[model samples]
Target: MLNYRLFGDLSSSAAPLVVLHGLLGSLDNWHTFARGQAGKRTVLAIDLRNHGDSPHVAGMSYRQMVDDVVAVLDTLAIPECYLMGHSMGGKVAMMLALQHPSRVRRLLVVDIAPKAYPPRHQALLHAMVGMPLGELSSRKQADEWLSATVKHPFERGFLLKNLGRKTEGQFYWQCNLPEIARHYLKISGFPTTDAVYPAPTLFIRGGQSDYVADTDLPMIRQAFPAAELVTVAAAGHLPHVQTPAEFTVLVEAFLG
Candidate 1:
């Protein structure tokens, strides 16, 4: 099961919003977005399984991840919620809405499509697989090792969040690295389902991102008939990071 933390008081008469992070991303990434919308509604930002403070699992797939999300909602007794997610999380949001439409009041999917994506980060995956988890002395050592194979300080830093040390001084990764590496194909592919979500849905794509292209819109519409496409100009995969003001505006309007 995935470990989760609920933010804000649910008893305060605030509508609930559940936010999920991307692959290798923690709930901390949504801190700013969650905080920005806290006044409008209660926020629940979860560390998806195998990431953040969540427990490591044996394998990962859209269906399994969606079930984890549903489990969290069930624990809270939340029959429905406004949902938002990015990258891998976006795929999860899509699955949840499709497979559990009665549980999602509205869905916001950021920078991902329902279509199968090509394996673009196999090299990065290979490098992560090579990391000597048992030999790492500290997070700094892991960073140094990852620096040799992973470029982009921000990306390296994100990956370093997974590096952790146990009380016995044994080095390990906070996330299920082995499981994720083994399920690379499943992770990149969309699950097959006849379930179509009819609820209001928004596909917020970054203008410079190849993750969600015009070609994917057809597949998105076929799965989510109510989905509307909105592009955030001058942004890449992380639209919330590059275009916060615009992103928040769209989100607010959609959720309102």
Candidate 2:
């Protein structure tokens, strides 16, 4: 099972919202947004397997990931809940809704489509896997090293969130880098499924991102007949992070 943090009143009449983060991301990425919605609805932010405080395992398939989510929900005694996920996590949410439709009330998939994606994160993965944690004296040095492959400072900072200090000066990655790198292909590709989840679904895309293309709508509609697509203006892949206020409004309205 994955480690999760709960916000708001779980006993409230409002249906609980479960959030799953993207690849190389943890529950912490959604902390602020979850906290913002805590007053109105119960929110559960989870660290998927191999990320953040969750148990590190070998297999990184969508099936295994969905099982981990189910385990968390089962332990919480939550029969069903609203699910929101980003990037790779969005794919997980889609799979879960298909495999166990009864467990999902509403679905929100952010900046991803239910189709196979070409290998795009290999360079980033190589940089992350090749980071010399033992040689790094400070997070700044680690950032400098990553900057060789990761050009964007913001992205480097985001990836640096996985850096954890074991001792006073030594830093190591909290994520299971080796396993993720090995299963990169699986992570990039969506698992084959003929199953359809006949529930209300929302696909939120970033206007600046190519992750969700016009070609994906037909597939999305075929799987989720009631699914609707919305785009966040001036936002990229991480729309929730870039345009949080707008994102929150969209979510609250849809979930309501």
Candidate 3:
């Protein structure tokens, strides 16, 4: 099972909310949001396989990722709960809802659609893999190295969160870069299914993100008959991080 951080009172009457983060992101991405939601209900933030503190396994597929989450729910004895996921994680949530509809009470997919995406993060992945972790004297140096490929400071900082120091000077990535790279194709592709999840579902897209396009709505509706899409103005791919306040409001309204 993937590593998870739980917040809130598990014994609360309200159903738990399971949060999954985007590609190259960990449970930490949802830490603040999960902590806020924990006041009313249980919030479980997960590190998908190959990311964060989770085991760096060989294969990467939607089925494998879904099973990892299911194992966590089974271990927690949670028969049903709400689920929210962003980007890559959103795809995982959608797959889980489709394959195991009864296990999901409500579903929220952020900034992604039920379709295949072209490999867009190759440069980022290459930068991550090529970074000489052993020689890095400080996080700043690592950031400098990443700056060559990852021009955006915010993105560089976000990716740097995965950098961990083993000793006084030596550093390594928390994610399994090699395996993720090997399975890039699988990660970019969505698994096909005739299955449908008819539960109330909300798809939140960033106003500036092309991840969820108008063309994808019909397919989304076909899979999730009750799904609705909302846009977060002036936000990009990571709307939860970019405009957390607005994002939280949308999530709370849907989950309520």
The better-scoring model by TM-score among 1 and 2 is 2
TM-scores for the candidates: 0.92, 0.98, 0.98
Clashing pairs in 1: none
Computed on alpha carbons, the lDDT of every model, listed in order, comes to 0.84, 0.92, 0.92
- Candidate 3 achieves a global lDDT of 0.92
Q: Per-residue lDDT for 36-84 in model 2, tens only?
A: 9856889999999999999999899999999999999899888899999
**Colliding pairs, model 2:** none
Runs with alpha carbons beyond 4 Å of true place in candidate 3: none
Q: Model 2: which ten-residue window has the lowest total lDDT?
A: 7-16
| Candidate ranking (lDDT, best to worst) | 2, 3, 1
lDDT measured at residue 165 in model 3 versus the true structure, 0 to 100: 90
Worst 10 residues of 3 by lDDT: 6-15
lDDT of 2 at 139: 86
